[model samples]
Target: MAEEALFAGPAIRRLRKREGLTQAAIAARLEISPSYLNLIERNQRPISARVVMRLVEQFDFDPRTLREDEAIGGVEGLVRRFADERFADLGIDREEMQELLSAAPQAAAAFARLYDNAAPASLAADDPFAASRREIERWRNHFADLDVAAEELADEMRLSRGDMGLALVDRLRERHQLSVRILPQEVMPDSLRRLDLHARQVQLSEMLSAASRNFQLALLIAQLEQRDQIDAIAKGARFEDEAARGFFTRHLMGYFAGALIMPYGRFLRACEATGYDLPVLLRRFGVSFEQLAHRLTTLQRVGQRGLPFFMVRVDRAGQFSKTFVGASTARFVNSDVSCPLWHVHRAFERAGELQVQFVSLDVAGEREGGWLTMARTVEGRGEPGETQFVVAIGVEAVLAGELAQARGISLRSDDAQPIGPGCANCHRVRCSQRSLPPRGRKLHFDTIRRGVTPFELASS
Candidate 1:
């Protein structure tokens, strides 16, 4: 068995600083020598199990929160930020970066925030869609409040297979006095759904599949019945601008539609029984792949929690259409693009093929570990300009044992293939798969000495 990484030294030091406690005071509390605590804080020594227990016992700290706050993911973000072109002159090495992360995580995060604010007035001002994507990326693809609200509503509704669609249709007709109509393709050209507010009618394209029809109807029902709740949640988010708020409001409605289709309790039971097999869940629930994957990310009930999964949808050009993350430690940021080597990109090559891969991501010297991921390419027809995309779903490597597709895959953290978020933020040197040098790197021209790497990224 591999040893558990002790990566909470920085977190411990931060906790001490917040409490205004000295190294000596914390050392006495943990029953360790002051020098040992100092070493741990310096990233030269790992925090021992005894120290962790002493911390929990003395300070009433939740172990999970501590682990998450100190995870290598945070360090990875710092590595990405430091790799920006503006910081190239600093010449920060991996070891020094680790020391900085371990000793002063709060300060590290503060600097990252400052860099974010100081770098640009609006990161994607010209492109509203890109700006919204970046906004969701900032939240790390998870909205805890939205998840809770959807799950709670699902639990309350308890709609079974086929019942949800009928219920939603009935709710719209009875409560809202709206008529549901599936219009001919030509009549509904360039649109999948349209609401005639004056006529009190909901019109959908006849070309939509059964799953699509049900989802659209359910989305309308959600807007009518859950608008106030969704609005309250959106208002609480305090989005920087109206576009972000509107984008997130639409997202919340989609979450409501998904939860209505796959209620939390039953979905969790089916997921466990089927080992989260996408095909099995789709067959059983009569839902589309995208719907099933979206529902899976919402299995975060208090006691009956399922695997911590995240789902991403991308087009052929590496544009992110949707993303949701459930794992606290395993985060997927900036779904606009990920590592080109990711299986999701390959799945697009062989249309309708299912691809599985295990990938690791390391930034600076800290290894962020691997995840068990599955991707499938999907094609659909809509209006003349309809967009088709591929969807990828993943769970943390530790939960791979529970997945059937992961049966033969090695679960070792080190055995997995290495990947990065994207070229702009990635700092992995000499990666043959690397498309471009990270923002902060200098391109070195070696006319005499040519290495196997295509691009040379110089830190100096």
Candidate 2:
């Protein structure tokens, strides 16, 4: 097979700037003349296989770094925004999109940003709760260094789930002078767990199950013991404000709690042995369904990787509360709420049952690839009127054959149910469940020409 020519001039230039290297310096390292290197930087010539190998061996740069992963992300964002009917005049095919990403990446990104500023407000536009949720979703629900630190700490502890919970309680009492107490639901009111630093007490509601009690205990320990680590991670995040930083820290505390409950190496092995079986893993690890789902997404450790899964949590009213898309899959952006046709919405009608579906990711959806999805409703322990939430997790379609949930899913079938990212961005012509016309399209009221759907978008 012939070698594919590499035209990643922009990527190379960016790397050169990052490393403070001159064109002559990079050329000397690649064993090429300075003039030839200049031509490559201008994208006038494709990089040879020999030079690509030298760059990899000499500079320790990721192959993907040169492949323009950042540029691809921007291009994808543009593609989604451009799919809207309003952008019909600026039509470009997939090949042209590639050229734009390769030769004019900065221009492509500028266009994506411009479209974002010009796009109409989504459903969550003015809602404060939705705003907070979007901030959490922005992190993609996983932090590599935080996970690594938690894993190292867990390894040192070397305790089972039960023992780990006991250890946390002891550490709080002995080290922080904080005592654990289980209080009646009426006394605690709406709170499941509350920490009274002034009173030196950490209270847990009696309504919580054994697993939940353990989780709450672990979370309290994280807040007290892992405060420094959490703060450090938040500092590195460079959040826009103190409030966002606090939210990020709280999320990291939860991550530490989950990692404590299910240690990385052990949890990964269990995932493989069980074939990613949710119930069995839940029993073995003594964690809630939601905890297990969240933990599943963090098995991103180098060689001991588990299946890449994207997880989302939503309420009965169709508001997305939390989401995490794995690295291997296409990123989901803009709004966390999925298309109306997704099974996550259906989970609200049938509470407490696992709903599985095979879905195709198209122009209408936020994510860029196919998925094998599983969703289920979970009731939270709260006051009488408190709402329950549904948690849905999806893996790339290619991994379906190995998944226990995908046993009878027919991974090869092309009969996947069509779903968009959301109504605001979806442009599928025959979708009966569309809530609104796509942002860029003009609504046509053709009394003379009736179509299958309510609105027929004019072709570009």
Query: TM-score, each model?
Result: 0.77, 0.74
Q: Write the residue-wise lDDT of candidate 1 on 1-460 in tens digits.
A: 2323455666777789878999999899889999988888776786654565577557734333344423334665666567777779989866877666656665666676677667565665655555555555445444556555666755555556657667667768877899888899889878989999899999999888778888898788789778998888677664567877788788778877777777666777888888888888887777888888888766655445566577888888776777676443444444357888788888877776779898767664446656788888765675432437888888766546658788778777777777777776676767777766676556787889986676776654
Q: Over the stretch 5-120, how does candidate 2's per-residue lDDT look in tens digits?
A: 45668867877888899999988988999999888888899786567556655674533344343323444555655677776887777678767777777677677666665644
- For candidate 2, the per-residue lDDT at 19 reads 82
- Stretches of model 2 off by over 4 angstroms after superposition: 1-114, 117-140, 155-157, 162-164, 197-199, 328-336, 364-368, 383-387
The list of candidate 1 runs beyond 4 A from truth reads 1-96, 103-106, 124-158, 197-199, 326-332, 364-367, 383-387
**lDDT (Cα, 0-100) at 406 in candidate 2:** 78
Give the C-alpha miss distance for residue 104 in model 2, angstroms. 8.4
Clashing pairs in 1: 10-102, 84-440, 85-439, 85-440
lDDT of 1 at 241: 72
